[model samples]
Target: MKTGRRLTSYALNYKKIILVALFLLTISVGTDLAGPFIAKNIIDQHILGIESVWNETTNGKSTAEYQGEFYKKEKNFSDNEEKGKEIRILQVGTKFVFMDEKLEFDGKRTFEQGILTVQKGDEKVNYNAKVLTNKELMAFYKLEIPGIIKLLIVYFGLLVISAIFQYGQKFLLQKSANRIIQKMREDVFGQIQRLPIQYFDNLPAGKVVARITNDTEAIRELYVTVLAQFFTSAIYITGIYAALFILDVKLAAICLLLLPILYGWIILYRKFASKYNRVIRSRNSDINATINESICGMSIIQAFRREKETETEFEKLNTEHFTYQNKLLSLNALTSHNLVGVLRNLVFVAFIWYFGGLSLNPASVISLGVLYAFVDYINRLFNPVQGIVNQLANLESALVAGERVFSLMDEQGEKVSTKRIERFCGNVTFDHVSFGYKEGEYVLNDINFEAKQGQTVALVGHTGSGKSSIMNLLFRFYDCQKGKIFIDGMDIINIPRQTVRNHMGIVLQDPYLFTGTIVSNVSLGDPSISREMVEKALKDVGVDRVFKNLENGYDEPVIEKGSTLSSGQRQLISFARALAFNPAILILDEATSSIDTETEAVIQEAMDVLKKGRTTFIIAHRLSTIRNADQILVLDRGKIVERGSHEELMLLKGKYYQMYELQKGNASLAG
Candidate 1:
């Protein structure tokens, strides 16, 4: 019922189309029933009462007989209703007349009296015919050619209207579905933008991709298929049943006996098949994530010689997907076969009842024409039954897809953007901060930091010593649990997220490049910044020579995340991107650690040029990198253990000096 309600809402938006279709279906069904009634009329009126004669001279003794013998042999009328009224013409010559007045035969001729009269040269026939029954009146209309033409016109009209409706539905369904899908994609992207950084840590990339791309697409297809197939099935079933009942009530009842069996099979299969399909969808998501991970880390996998192990892992997921898919297919096929078999059995039973009864008693009678029409009605019934079952299957799939799509649509993200704008300075401070991804086991505990405007504050720490956590708190990616972070003496929470981010620009150790011209990637997030500004930023980042070397310079296509460019070039482009924004505060989080000596020298020179006017926060392992920093803080665990200038830290011989000595020794050994 939930599924029905959801689907109904989508369909009700186009009520005009649905109503037209129903009207046409009604007309089509009526025309379809007219064929059987016509056959019955021809047998009773023309075949039975028909008598033809010929004059013959054989001997002195002559005999005259009616052609009623031929009618009896044809079994066109029942034999038990006594003989029809036979009138002999006394003239010498023989003549024949068709019963132009309609007649019904139960081995007797009957017709309407006082309405139709026959005369030969002003002498009327003496016989009075029986009155026409209501059934005979209806049968008469179908027997004639004009009535058949009327019904044919109705049938053809319905076929044309149905085809037009089908074409319109395809166009409208696709148009509406694409709009709905685009909106869903935007909603998912918006939600992820507002989510905390920890959300990404807990959720797999593959799962998110499945929800955004695959699940949303499934929901859209569900709407289209359900709209197309479900109504068609319903119309077919209704038309089939009505036609069967009109032909013979007893036969229709027998054919309908298979319905309960068909429905039971559907109910059973629908339950199991839905479950298996959901499993298959989940397994498919796992496979996609695995493939994405393997490709993204191809170098690491190859260096470790883990290709065989990765293949084994992928095979496991593939086999699971195969098993679930087969289960679904088997159940679907079983339900289809069961419904068809039951319907076939019912048809066979109806046929036997109809034929065997005719054979048993001479009084049990039906016209040859009507019997032939019933056979066609029996064939029509199967089509509607099959259509109904297939529609139900589509309905089930749509229901499942809608649930997943709505689930994503209903998710909530962090409340961050109530106010659009606020004022802020570059003075950043984190007071007694404590943070954790999970509820317990804090990664940063009781942290404290302050960076005044234009101050170069360097964080000297080992890996996992909470250097990045400080930057994360400063950027408001995750709020501190125990204390508060202030930007320009204002509570970070008071300002809009975008407002806070506007004051800071970050350069990560490993930067990403999009597939576009170099200028385009740099101009992102600040489209107002000019190409001239981008060029200046690149030159300031000491990558002007690299850009000049390229054939198209800033217009050179990066192609597949800047694969055409080296790692140093990629980093230089990212530096230019950050500089183009011209932020008040800059964060270089181990940004130069991955570069070679020559590229590092170029980056170091660029950094020296850009750091003059803006406040900078440097998180680095190389002591020489921050030797000229205005202040240095050494962190161990989550707390600051030492704070001084480079010479002061060395004089104190704390953890900073020890790490510096260790790295210096390694550098000498390499040299």
Candidate 2:
């Protein structure tokens, strides 16, 4: 919940749209609340208000005193004031009119269309009358059937206006939801960029991808489904309660008990729901990671014939995911939605029982119209409750998703310096640097080294001897546990990683290419490298003949990971890529290991040109390539076991000499 609240802060940025949506939502609720009251008026004023009939007698010639039921102007007038009174009407003239209850004039009168029209000299006046025999008058009182039709129209208009407002609010809410999602995705992506290399080393690619794509997608549901339902339900509940209070304060107060019951249910629901949702989310991430790993390692899996084993593992994770999902489903069924339905029916039963008691009272005044409206309002109240209950499942998933997304965003990464360095000399130094990917297990200890401007330094070592770790340190992919690294005599910690790496380039053991054309791969989307630069760099790598067979040459399409191309061809492109950048410092880690001896020989001169006047670090298992290097460091178990020129190391007869002799024997055998 803490994490969800924090993630919700991003919504504060789009206050304008949210506020407008809320306003529309409130107005919609107001229109809906007007419904039952309009219904009550239709019943009390126009539908059922006419039931009492009057009979009377008077003794006179052509004079009659007709006794009729008295009608009060006020609907709720005190019963104590007048329990029952007959309206007295008598004829005093040739028109045979006795008297009118509400209006009196000494003149001839005639009743037409339920209107008593009186002619007093030249002036004519009209007054409404309750015609006992007229079936057109639907009410006991004064309102006519035409008035009932107009009331129905007004009632329907309120509903139509409510529908319009509801549509507007729902549309605006979803729009705000999408905007909030966009902002969250951007933050997630930006955080991924700043995280340390070890973070990726420890976590799977698919899990991180899930955090950015899947989890954030769930958060979007939070806004569109959960929050939308929450606000709507809240407004509806409030309106129902307000209407109830207006009708009967005692009954309204009694209805408030269900609120705390609902609140407690929600609190309990969240406790269990969050636990189940967490496991569900974790399993989802694991499934994604498993799929990604399977795809990437398909070749190895097929080579080893582990298809059955792979399927078994995937089934385990898939089953675990589904099991937790079932638990959540069961919890939802038992707790919120179905429970609200039961609770709603319970409230309705209680209301009906209470209203029936009031109707039985001889003296107690109770309008049947108000009793119907009470039932209607109570039903309205529970609809929102059931609505909120229906969204509980979605709400649980969204809150869980919010927890994961904000937790990722909260991860501390490499600090970014405000300074941007455009240029720097290529003199690099590592002063007593000690580092480890894990605590207390150092991969490089007290590693002191320097590669001056235009110097070529070679790091030759066995596998797991920290050659790549040193490169990792130099690139600031991981900060050292101790000591400082200097680039052009500037401490690297103070320099932005981008700025420090501006003059450095690395060609990894396995080069990666994005989905693009050959020219784009060489340029790597750097706008500074024009077509001319791309062409020159490709030709300079001495692999132009291989590309010349394609109709588009450098323009030929490169699929993902350059899977269609040979390893040698990919290496040549990567070499061209490094050279095109023209960095002051270049580090090649097994760059030529993939190429055949003949191809290496073909590009040897171009390689020289690429390495010319640049501080270079070459890590290779092949001893022949580094014979001309200015200095060579042989690392054994995180320590530099030997450091000298090839000639100097050969004379020393140490670890370097032993490896050289072994490699030379292998080269002879291969030949």
Give the local distance difference test score of model 1. 0.69
Instruction: Find the candidate with the highest lDDT and give its number.
Output: 2
Cα lDDT tens digits, model 2, 1-671, are: 48766756877878799999999999999998998998898886655543222222233221122233234323334455432333323222222222235444434567765566766556677765644432322222333456678889998999999999999999999999999999889888988888877888889999999988999999898898889999999999999999999998878888898899888888888899989999999999999999999998999999999989999999999999999999998998787667877787778777777776765554455666898899899888888898887788888888888888888888987655546566656889999999998999999999998888888899999999999999998988888999999988989887778777777788888999889999999888889889999889889988766565887778899999899998888888888898888888898998878878877776677867777788989999888999989899999899888999999999999999999999998989989
* Highest-TM-score candidate: 2
Off by over 4 Å in 2: 52-143, 415-418
lDDT of 1 by residue, 1-671 (tens): 36456546655665565566555544554555455555555444444322322122221222222332211212223355333333321111132222323222223222233332443333444333333344533332333345446645665665666566556556655565566567667777788777777777866787778878887677666655655455555665566677668767887777777678767866877788788877777787798889888988898999999999999999999999999878777776776757676777768776887777764554566656667667766666676667666666555665676666555555666655645343345788878889875678788888787878877899978788889988887887877778888877889877666677876789888888888889888987466799999989988988875556788888888876787788889889988888888888899888888777788888888888798778899999777889988889898887899988889999999798899999999999999
Tell me, what's the RMSD of every candidate?
A: 9.4, 8.8
RMSD value for candidate 2 = 8.8
Clashing pairs in 2: 49-140, 50-139, 50-140, 90-98, 91-98
Q: Candidate 1 versus the native: TM-score?
A: 0.79
TM of each candidate vs. truth: 0.79, 0.86
